[model samples]
Target: MADIIESAGVVLAYGVAGFAVMALGYLALDLVTPRRLSSLIWTERNVGAAIVMSGQMIGVGLVVAAAINASEFQRGLGVGLVSTLIYGLAGVIVMTLVFALVGILTPGRMGATVLEDRDGRPHPAAWVQGAMYIATAVMLTAALS
Candidate 1:
């Protein structure tokens, strides 16, 4: 019973820590982006922002999941936490680089392309960028896990 309780506490602690780490990843992405993502999504109701932000958050989550799956948290949750941070940050950084690379290859400026609209619709370039972000996450998660 005592061991079970201790294990439960560890899980809870790590779960919270994992979420905080993910939030930090989001902040990092927000800093890189030109527009305030929250304002664009909530205030402007920008579908482009919604898709891109959603992809970014999911990408970070996949990295955390991979870290948790790969690390032996039962041995030492502290070590597990550190591994999670390391792997998660790597995943975020890789995702960011993929986004930039895609944007560069894309005809127009990626940031501006994300905000571009045509005929009252979100531009196709934004969708492509979001897809690239998600695909990169999936690939990294597979390698990490």
Candidate 2:
């Protein structure tokens, strides 16, 4: 039916928007760290890097989902897509800022610390930084709702 097709189109649009936001998140994370993120995870097999990236991706997803849900209810499809993109980018920015702030307050650089591994195991800082990303996303979700 025409309605079904239209619904599918909306879904596609939203999907693209979410993907764009996630891509930005990845790029933001890549910028903060010293080594190339892809190399760190894929080539080096860095557990710490993997954990940090996973946390960022998950956090971005949460914020994107919340933005989409809230925007869809309050506005139409177009506005929803735009808002989702905006909110998702905001989430990325906030997460990056938090990372930087923590880096400043902590004894060592947060990004470098999280990427460190010992005997193939991730550093404790990795877990803490990862949680920070998720926690920041949770706060953003609350703000969106």
Clashes of each: 0, 0
Q: Alpha carbon lDDT of residue 71, candidate 1? A: 71
Q: Estimate candidate 2's alpha-carbon lDDT, on a 0 to 1 scale.
A: 0.92
Winning model by lDDT: 2
Model 2 regions more than 4 Å off: 72-75
RMSD of each: 1.9, 1.3
Across 1-145, the per-residue lDDT of candidate 1 in tens digits comes to 9999998997787787678767876777677678887888888888886778788888788778888888767678888888877788788888888878887787877877787656668877778777877888899889986
Residue-wise C-alpha lDDT for candidate 2, range 21-126, written one tens digit per residue: 9999999999999899999999999999999899999999999999898775356787888888988899999999998998999988888999998899999989
Worst 10 residues of 1 by lDDT: 111-120
TM-score of 2: 0.95
- Model 1, residue 77: what's the lDDT? 82
State candidate 1's TM-score.
Answer: 0.88
